[model samples]
Target chain A: MSIIKAVHLRKRFIVKKKEPGLKGALKGIFAPKKIIINALDDVSFSMKKGEIIGLIGPNGAGKSTTIKILTGILQPLSGEVEVMGLNPQKKRAEVVSRIGVVFGQRSQLYWDIRLGESFELFRRIYRIPDEEYNANLELMDSLLGIRRLIDIPVRQLSLGQRMRGEIVSAVLHSPDILFLDEPTIGLDIQAKRNIRKFIREINQKKKTTIILTTHDLGDVQELCPRLVVINKGKIIEDGALDAIVHRLAPERILQIDTDKVKKDFTYPHCKMIKCEENKMWISFNRENVSASKLIAALSAEVRINDLQVKEPDIEDAIEQIYGEG
Target chain B: MRCAVQSWFEYPLEMLCWIIFIPLYSFGGLLLLKVISTQFSEIGGWTFHGLAFFYGLGIVTHGLHVIFFFAVWHTNYMVLNGEFDRILLYPMNPFFMFIIQSFNIAGYIDITPGIIIFTYACLKLNLDWNAVAILKLIAVLIGGTLIRTGIFMIAGAIGFFRDTRNAVTNFMVDFLAYNTTAFPLNIYPYGIQVILTFLIPVGFINTYPAQDFMGMDNTFSIPINLSLCTLLVGIAFFLLAYGFFRFGLKHYKSTGS
Candidate 1:
């Protein structure tokens, strides 16, 4: 079942046209010019219950605008948004209650207060039940080890620790849908892994529907099963992660190390990508020729000592998708 | 409010500076008034004590405004910085949370001098300590605060229309509203009085109440009972301000990235 849906969503921003220099500043004061910018142009997408979907796009491509509209922080110029069976604009409070959002660049916690105090304030704000709140806290503690950092002031905590606390607070109320915008924007590898693990555990234990927007392709590759690629305020592509990769980069690379060197060889549906001495790299479309087939064909020609297969990296695939879009 | 208090204790020196600086600043204003009164024993047909009484009323109301409406004062900054987005995400009326979060503890510091000065002026004036007078004073103070905050809310509502660094709202609250409360309204021309009393209603915050307390001839054509005028106009202005805020919120174009 679709937990969130948006139809023909559109938003425009009126930006003042400031001219350069002192003369322009004076002219601007007298006769300010305004240009209308289409922040979101007929964007449309939907997410199923408990599905993790990545909303990927280039900067200024309306990814954050779309997220703001869905979260009800922004009202689109024209559109219909339904989150958890309620119109987000018309029933904002109700819609917000069912969702949690975290902006990685900004924190919602009080900077001077302890992390636990912030959680308690949120608990009162959300009116979460004591038992459920405690259970969720325990779950967060186990998943992110947040209890150890709870006593420290928010400002004193490291970026990674603060982000963990942010994630924990966002979910303390057991929101059914979580909107994570660049949740791992500045985290180190270890922090990123911990956050990814936390995200997976929450989705598994609570069936939380998550909509993640980030430039980090690793996040999309590791977490999102589905992808909604947007560019220029429009949905460019929407499908499975592997399908996107397959559609963008269909060929897989196979590296072979042989005991004996051989002449440059090619077979039907297989091309020699590179050859250096006893080692050769071959590329072949998986649909036309399986890895086994290509390997057997290469093995017959060269005395194979070692073999390795490399699937296309998601980074390259996403870059291709973005570049094409 | 609790969060603000907790944060206050986090830096003892800054908090102490904040608490001390408010009354110290007000003391400078007091010194200015003294210099003025020393030269001319009376201004606007009222004695020095009478004018000081009005000043006290204005200070207390200003402090109350700060306490209750700090969020409205900061709406422009919040909107500009995109902090207002978080308020919308909470599962409650954003205005309610804004007001609750804005109950600044340091605002009480501003009230200390106002209370002390007002009490001293009243004692000097030898006003009858009747129950009715005391009750009326309480009503006037509450109403004055409402008027002050209503003006603030009206100014803050402008944030919804544009991204501002607070030049407009500051002009409205700090210069127009706050300055008008500092002295007798009768000294100003009739047109200015109308603007202060009917338009921004800064005169209602203190001047009208002072006139009634001193039993002086009110400048306005309409006769006003102190308590009734304050209660009626205070509630009316506050509702209008809140209504304006809600109307402005419909046009809230958040600083979307």
Candidate 2:
């Protein structure tokens, strides 16, 4: 069963024009002008159950807008969005209870209260039974390792500790679907790794459907195998991560550093992409040109000191997808 | 509920301030009441002590509203700054959260002054300290706090739709209007009585009790006083507020913090 189904979910925001100074203010009273900005234009996508999908986009690419609509915080101008077989806008309370969302920097816990109090409050809110409550508590404490921090006031916890506690609070009742926006943002390397591991573990073990929106490519590449790239309020690519990488930049890049410049041997099989500073890089399809043959031909002419293979970065490929479209 | 109240104990400075402020305010209130008592023999048909008694009750009630619903009024600041987005993401009603956030001991400052006036009125009035009067006073309390708190809640709910909640100024205007008019409903022109009893509802907050203790007659005594304007208008205002809140939420564009 598809957990999320959104089709042509158009959200248009009115950009009101503000006049300047006294004269403009006086004129504004009489003739106010508004410009319409299509935040999301004819956007469509569907995610199957237990699928961990990456929602990647630049600023103002309708990432938060889409999430808000799906969460029933805002209504779309037109089109349909269904989460778990319920219209989010019409059935907000029911839909919200089933999905958990964590805005990376936002802390949902009380500022002066301990983590234990917040969890208890959530327990009352979700109306979880004592047995299920203990089970989920044990699971969250192990997955996020927030057991020791439970008694500490939220304001006293370190950023990483606070974020872990926040994540636990979001999923305390074990929501079926989770939306994480920039979850690893502002975290140190070790904290980021822990978060990534926990996210992957839950998706694999609990079968929690995860839709992550992030500008950090490493989070998506490592944690989300399925990628959905959006730009300017429209989706440019939606498929597996490897497919987007291959489609956006087809060939792998090969760099050769030599002691001297190499003679131009336009290998019909391989294409020379760029050459600079006694170094040249070429791209060749593996199926078209054999790596040994190409390397042997290039090395036969110039004394190659270092050779390395590089695939196009997912970040660049997504950016190129935005640029070309 | 228990945990929310316990959190207040953790902040000693905050609770201590409330303990200090409540007495400070009560003492200050007596000084002003004394000035009014000395010059003005009576407001409306009551004696100096009767006016002082109701004034203390009003202050105590106001103090309660300040402490219990302080966070409710502060929601405007929280919502405007986008701090409320986090509260919204929580499973609980954000409005309910604000009410439970703090235990307002801050307004206790007025109790000292209120007690001073009450003690002074008791001594000066020299009335029988009997069961009936005390029971009537208790009844007045039940109605007074409800009406006052109800007004504040209506105003707080109005904040969901407007830029600023300046409706609190109505408190001053209400005190002035009800305190000046001599006698209860009857002495006034029928038109004025109807407006006070039904349309405005401010009269019941204090004047209804003034009639009960003083053995005076009002235009519309017990039944109308407790029924019309106060409770009815209060409930209607509450429903109106609920409507405004849901309407405002649809248009609310919570700013990104």
**Which stretches in model 2 have alpha-carbon errors above 4 Å?**
A12-36, A263-274, A284-297, A322-325, B90-98, B102-204, B207-223, B227-229
Compose the digit string of candidate 1's lDDT tens values, residues A1-325. 6899999999998999999999999998899999988989898888889999998888888888898899988888998888988988789999888899998888899999999999999999999999999999998888999999999999999999999999998999999999998899989999999999988888988999999999888898899999998888888889998888898898889988987766668788888878787788888888899888777877888889999999987777877877876
| Per-residue lDDT of A58 in model 2 | 81
lDDT of 1 at B252: 74
TM-score of each: 0.93, 0.82
User: Worst 10-residue stretch by lDDT in candidate 1 chain B?
Assistant: B219-228
lDDT per residue for candidate 2 within A191-248, as digits (tens), equals: 8888899899888877899989887889998988899888778988899898888877
The per-model lDDT (C-alpha) reads 0.86, 0.71
Q: Tell me the spans in candidate 1 whose CA falls farther than 4 Å from its real position.
A: A19-28, A31-33, A256-282, A289-307
Tens-digit per-residue lDDT, B103-146, candidate 2: 46554554455556666666776768688667656555555555
